[model samples]
Target: MRFLIDFFPILLFVAAYKLQDIYTATAVLMAATVLQTGIIYGIDRKLQTMQKVTLVLVLVFGVLTLVLQDERFIKWKPTVLYASMGIVLGAALWGWKKNFLQILLGSQLTLPTAVWGRLTVIWVGYFLFMAAINGYVAAYYSTEDWVNFKLWGYIFPVVFIIGQGLYIARYIKDDSNGAEKS
Candidate 1:
């Protein structure tokens, strides 16, 4: 259910693209993202920082894509988002000596300090990799190819999330017995 809500925008965008064109797809993406955000806010009662950022970026870039009649803006949106996330996480972890991921999720999951630091570093690297790959594809590929890549790129996140879950599983404490469980 949650996954559907989260993915419907991209799914709609792809459908719109296949039915019409990039401009139509951009419009659909904008509307779907707005709807998605509202649904999430209604359910969660508040928006995460990333959710807000994503909404704003989608709207801003969607409008630019429409107004300027340039699909590049929409295509590059993911790259910008991924790069910004990587920079923020990297800067917070290295320069400020603070782990933003830990600060955000610490209340929900208790992990050793070192684990948090390592997790943040891993996230930073992942974000950077995503950013670079998206940028490369968007710049060098045709619009159709870029759109296909967008549809297929779900594999990267799926794999990363599964790997992350496995990595953290051993450290998660089992509340039933107050013992760590893998």
Candidate 2:
């Protein structure tokens, strides 16, 4: 559903890369991301901030990759995106004295204020770690290696998200018992 839709562009990019070349894959990724955003907007009538940022970065970096005939542009995209998210989260938490992650998800997940703060810290660390890894792989590795990492690196986020779910499970209110439980 939403997960597939969000990943639609990356999936298409990978398939196109396998079928053709980097330029072709870049074009496909750009088009697919635009289409994905359009479909989301048509249904929701609004795009999340992160979605909009991703769309813009895909278009900008994708076009640069095509225009400059350099794969570096495309390869650097993930690092830029991850770094931006990390910066925003860290800034919100420290500079603004706010936890934007908690603010964003507070409506859906009810937790003690302390839990929310800790969750925000966890997300900030996760994002920073991802950013660092992306930067490292993009800089020190070959284009082929970076592309391979793009596919395999998804495992990190998946594992992190599952860990978050497990950590939050204990905090979620139980409807059956009408109380929180460990």
Candidate 3:
């Protein structure tokens, strides 16, 4: 399930941290991530380029965590992941294609291009904020704080996304109403 897919990494991160040996934990995390990716790909019968790229990045960073013996590399993983998704989503708004969020939900939802653009910008800004916050926390806070933030910091983006959806629902008419026409 999508819920599990998102939560699994965080759970692994906690496990890795608790295990206390960066190299061994990194290997375990990397293996788990690969398996996760493979399962998703098998179920879908095709791998999204983004998913493949993400797996690669995670592996690379996980290895870096072991090699460098500093948790900073792993700590910044979400920041890079979110920033990349945000940029890609924002760029998709420039063309006719809606980004990942829309692709997943658009069948059951409706919103105009302007609304989508606004949503994308909001996401982009949030990602930037997350990246900055992650850097600050990892640099200044203890490892425990960094881990807690990784789990709890998801709140900000979820709230922002819900707010965006509510705003779109208020302003944008349903798809059947032809409100999405540019």
Best by TM-score: 1
CA lDDT, every prediction?
0.95, 0.88, 0.75
Q: After superposition, how far is residue 178 of candidate 1 from its true place, in Å?
A: 2.9
Task: Enumerate residue pairs that collide in model 2.
Answer: none
Distance from true location, Cα of 174 in model 1, Å: 0.6
Expressed as tens digits, the lDDT of each residue in 17-126 for candidate 3 is 67765456567778888988888878888877768877988898888898888777877776787777767776776665656666755676677756666666777788
Total backbone collisions for each predicted model: 0, 0, 0
- The predicted structure with the larger TM-score, 1 or 3, is 1
Better of 1 and 2 by TM-score: 1
lDDT of candidate 2 over 1-182, digit per residue (tens): 88888777878888889889899999999999999999999989999888899999999999999999999899889888988998998899889999888888888888988898888889888988888998899899987777778888889988998999999999998777655543
Q: What is the lDDT of residue 133 in candidate 2?
A: 93
> C-alpha displacement of 154 in model 1, angstroms?
0.4
By lDDT, the best candidate is 1
Cα lDDT of model 1 by residue, 1-182, tens digit: 98889889999999999999999999999999999999999999999999999999999999999999999999999999999999999999999998999999999999999999989989999999999999999999999898889989989998999999999999998797755552
Q: Residue 163's C-alpha lDDT in candidate 2?
A: 98
**What lDDT does model 2 reach?**
0.88
Model 1 spans > 4 angstroms off:
179-182
TM-score (C-alpha) between model 2 and the true structure: 0.92
Off by over 4 Å in 2: 176-182
TM-score of 1: 0.97
